[model samples]
Target: MSIIEARSILILILTMPTLTRQGSFGSILSSWSDSNTRGPTISLHAAAKPLMRFMYHRQVLAFIKKNRDTPLSKPIMEIYSSYLAFKHLSPSTKTTILAELDVRIASRADANAVAESLLDYAANLLDSPDANVRISTWRVLAELAHHRSTATAVLAVQPYRRLVELLNHKNVEVLETAVCALAYLTQWPDGAQAAVSPEILSCLVKLLDSPNSGIRRWTCLILGDAAQHQATEMAVSGHLCIGLISLLSESDSEVVENATYALSWITYSSHGVEATLNADILDVIPALLKSPTPQVRRWTCRIIGHIALHKSRASILRLNPCSMLVSFLSDVNVQLRESAIYALSWLTQWPEGAQAAVTAKVLQYLPALLQYRKPHVTKWLRRMLKHLAQHEAMALAAFRTQLVPLVRLGTLVVSSMQGRYSALTKFLMWQTKARLWIPWRGEMGREVNDVFTGMFGGRKRRENGALIPRTS
Candidate 1:
């Protein structure tokens, strides 16, 4: 028929109120395939594909809107079977439907409900032989994985193995989208568990060198999350450490942030720490500590803290990060401040680090942190102050600053015992001093002191009109 006739028919179908109605929608689709309707020529049918796809998309959206306030299971399944599964629907049409669903999944509060219902169909589509279908499916899964409520559901379906398989796909877009899905999925503990396999890590490590910045960024994010697991941390400690450290110098800020975050987790192990040191991570750490991104700085401090927990304090001392870490105590970001305090806490366990921290005036910045209510921040802050108090100069500095009442008590306790205990005893004393201090006057103080004296195998006597514990 004529072009005008086709336009007239398209408008009539689009304007029909019943076109998107429950059962009538399928009848319209069936009309396109039936050969007996008005004897339309082959070219006329071919010419209507775009308009047909548009009508299908419009109907799918209208159907969703009409049912949006209600339970989505029946309507979503209907859309899936009618539009997504129809044999004659073009790949692009299906992709459009999935894309629209992705938008809804991302912006709506009921996204988990939609994702839960769509997971089975989406999982089946992941195995489609069509590359476009696979890419669209990955995008939908990625959006689903973004929600914590739906992330475990995504994991339960076990699509990670299929995602790993796509890492080798020749299409760069497919590889990028696949890694993006893995990046979101691995953020959860269960997802990370599924992602720690040998094949997955190998693919991720290879993608670190991908020419596409997004692949490298997503790969780092996946590795970073996966590296939190003990098995994954040790597995990533080898050559992967070198690859991630190299990415620290990349011009992309996201790659650097994620790479640093992954390194922070990996370096939690002794093996990982040694590998990172051998990789010269220290050389870049100073710069990363000053990174414009708060996350990068926070992760960089975490890397230093993990390394300091090892026997390699001497190596980290050479970096002299105490002043930088101390500076972070005054930072606006509470998390960065927490990370800095954590690193300083580990570093100051050594006498040399304590002295460096004193020289950096860490005491000046610490009093303000006492006002912060975060338990982790307070825990690390207490450790950092206690560590600083172990050294005489730092203790004197704390006394001068009148840092905190507890810190002052630590100073008095440590100073009273100086030259009386062995180095190991002194360290152990500081580690437990917080629990040993008692604020009572008279009998309570005496009893607490006696307990401390007994624990150290010492006897107490008056010296210069003050009680002193003498090791016997």
Candidate 2:
């Protein structure tokens, strides 16, 4: 349960003989090792019981070290690494050995040493004319980093220069493994930000554009996770947001989520959100809102909120930024409706933003709430009404000269509340302060239910419940 134990397990799982076995071993390792122990030191005794117990792997490692010069040394060394992966060996042991290997590989005198010998074998395996060998070598190299930072650093020397040479290899698995290995290698301390070199970025970008959704998703995820401020800068400066936006329509959920999240994060930086606003990219929101997936809609709403919150000028220039949101107040999906309401309220809290909403005639949509059936729908509507009513002067001004459509809908506002206490509370408050804004007419009845019934028709009794007559 220590960092040493976890890293050891990571190394072991990485060296598993077969991919399927690797998965089984990884699950076991993950479950047995707590996240806090994810670094180095400590060890795992293979839980294989009396026959193949892995607890004392140090003995096996000692045997391999002492006999490393023998004819059986090569296979024994490989078996030892595989066993380490199987036992979930500590990363410290792997890193110590890998560092020694790096020094040996770098020294001509020690070029023929066990460390160098193993790496040379790995290199040869990577270059094998056989596709399986190349794929296997790539996997080993990728996993090597979990145990050895030196091996990780060694891969970045050419930073996939040699791997790139083999990219055109006829085998897709080899190509895929090479890319995966490069990504995995880049996670090492030495390879961290260095992995974002021009060549690697180009390769990843190309893969992102590949016809394969899996490749695109993985590539995007890697780039998003590894390349931080730079990627966002490039995305903004190069107008890549458009292409990134298009990826939202990807068939894969992972691709859509990562792409959407990445774009949103990118737009959060200085002048980033402003850039999108300048381009008038708000039109993208409605499509995303209509997405069949709830998560997509939630993220889209979040992105819109981020833009509105970050850009004051953009908010002012866009008088109707939230004009489209009023319709979503009655969405059948409660979560989307909640998110929409939050965005609208957040925008309205800024005085200039409220002024813009008033100027855009957003109040007109309030009259349509009477047509909705859910109490929850009316609940949020009352909240909005109360908020507007609190700003009595702004409300009256927006109501009279600013919102022609709302006025045209008539003064049935007081009657619309009928028996709804929430609506009634807001109506009373509004009338108390804005009496001059109201036009007394007989058609504008005083009873809450009567006003709404006139506009949307009366509720009818049903065996199950009270159901409103739905005109649309």
Candidate 3:
């Protein structure tokens, strides 16, 4: 018997004696019934005290009232009686119960017995030949997969293979639900291990072109989740990255957001980065910059950041994201401006990247970014320009113009007002501000330091009052 059946019988069985004391078993049964047809006769083995039985009856009535308003609650209760009364409830009635169970599972506030019974029976329904049954089964299992505790609980009996098989279901609802269920499974590590296979991943990629915006969005999310792990990322990198990039042009703004998210994770790894570059994903950035939605622009910057990991600034330069991203730095949205700064920071870290920034006309708008008040953006922009100034070309460009002197004045005023400025801090600030010494860190810094050493007689000489080269 299902939990629903057992629970109803338990309620009626426990309350029987109280009714029995009033009259015969027939009268007891009649009182329990609607005075229409006879109710199920469940025999109870133990007897309880009169007061205890009354409380049990009250508890059962309270349970009935609590669930009465839900659409399927009546039939869920009536079904047990229907089975005892030996009547066939239509498929629609059962489906309604399944839908309600879905909501309960989603909210994590399920009736324990009902959920347990559904999990037990849902696997069998996957083979029920009826699409509705399969759809309900998928929905229930998907709901269970939504949470880690329930996902682990149901993993053993979750019909992992059957869920993947439904990806090919002719019914759109079944296919959508199947992909969504599998996507939710990917949230848990074990589920990701089970769901991410060569065949299944290829199937997921196929859904990217599903014409249905919902299907494309869910497919992107599923691939995105699996790609979080290195093993899965290495598995799906090449074709999956290509598929996600192609979706950047999708008319649906949300679809583009999810696709961008997927691309970001997929390309986060060195291997993934290599695969993405091999696929020439840089080709897509120029077009994405044209998207009307700022979110698309925001995520596009993130995607570029991940692809920048290989540190192939030249590869990035060929597509010229420097000018494009610089344009976003002035956007009113703080996030967009930050993303732009972050993307530029990566490109500016190396000499070739810094040169690319200059070549892309970043200097033309370099002064505008200083007006942005977000701390991180300002910091990244400073570092980016610091790296760019190391090229000397950028130094000459800024020093010859009004940019450097104004920035130096601002820094000195802030430092003076803050009351914490020191000799070393002032020297370092002036050096960075004028792009004189690159701070003795990386090859670029060391190279610039070497040049300063040659020009100034020695590094120590500058500390003794021999000033850095005159920008004039």
Candidate 4:
């Protein structure tokens, strides 16, 4: 039968009673099989093609519905095998089949075997002349890359070059899906190494300029995952750093987020840090720090922290991001707060940064962070406070602003301050001694110094017009 005849039969089957429909469908299949006993003929195969496609589609749909809540039975492999044998499934049918496979791979433990079974066939379809087939195939490959076992299986087949080549497809949908597949595939170091050729890197850099935000976003994701490996990190450093920095100004939040995330990972290498600094990333940081997206702000802080590792303190200090970073210490997101504190810890390692931290009133928020039970928060907080304490001016600022809370917690140990006493205790004793002796200065200055010197084994000095504790 032709497609029109097949459709009429399908309508008749649907209009019949359920039992009658089954019997009629079985009879049609039986008649088709009986016809096969004769010599194969063009008319017979042409008539059966659409009928066979419809039958397989119904069987796959029914199988998916029945097994929605359960593991796929072994029969699914047979159904999938027979389904793949049809070389001319419509785009819609191909999409539905691939989508079901994607869902199954994502939700079912046993689906890895199914995915592995389909890997070669799916890889072959990546080059299908039809855009829909290629797009659907890219999506299934992307989903497969999500699982470690299937991801390795996908890598074993080596589709990275084809994925990279598809990035040049004229269709934006194909380009987006191709980039997405690369994004997931590059999550593995080996996969990243395979996918990130010089040509592909150049393509991704150019894609950063794409008007489609999704293309840019997935490109950033690919670069970000590629940057995790040291080899790819260095490879991506100078070439892609500038493109990524430009994306920081993107109107789309997710594009900005992935760009920032990619930059953060890129900054892990010294070469990446150098390239980012050369690209003038500092000028964009203050704006990124104020982004409404918490992830953008968090990763921007991380970029600053990593740049600080390269001793780019002067440039960062010139930008004055310390104030903005300090503001995030009070943010409701714990992870952002942690990233801010981490950035401040690195920034405060120098006197300028310490002064900036003090000028930003970081101490005001320090005590509240102490109440957080998370180890990472406490660790970064302590390091930030320690760096702040290294400078006498910042130390005095902390002493004046947070002394009561620090003393109450009893964990505030200013390594720069002398003697066995806590900095707070020593500062308090010295303050009291000064106040008591001021009235009798002419007669008791030396004697009072000697008294406190013997008691605490240290003395106080006026440095830059600020009282600083001196070690004996």
* Backbone collisions counted per model: 0, 22, 0, 0
> In lDDT terms, which candidate is top?
4
TM-score of 3: 0.63
Q: What is the C-alpha lDDT of each candidate?
A: 0.75, 0.53, 0.66, 0.76
Q: Could you give the C-alpha RMSD of every candidate to the true structure, in order shown? A: 15.2, 24.7, 15.7, 15.1
> Best to worst by lDDT, what's the order?
4, 1, 3, 2
Over 4 Å off, model 2? 1-78, 81-130, 140-159, 162-171, 179-192, 227-240, 251-253, 271-281, 312-349, 352-472
Off by over 4 Å in 3: 1-90, 111-121, 154-156, 355-386, 389-472
Q: Tell me the deviation in Å of residue 267 in model 2.
A: 1.6
lDDT of 4: 0.76
State residue 437's C-alpha deviation in candidate 1, in Å: 7.4
Distance from true location, Cα of 223 in model 4, Å: 1.5
lDDT, candidate 3, equals: 0.66
Clashing pairs in 1: none
Better of 1 and 4 by lDDT: 4
lDDT of 2 at 415: 39
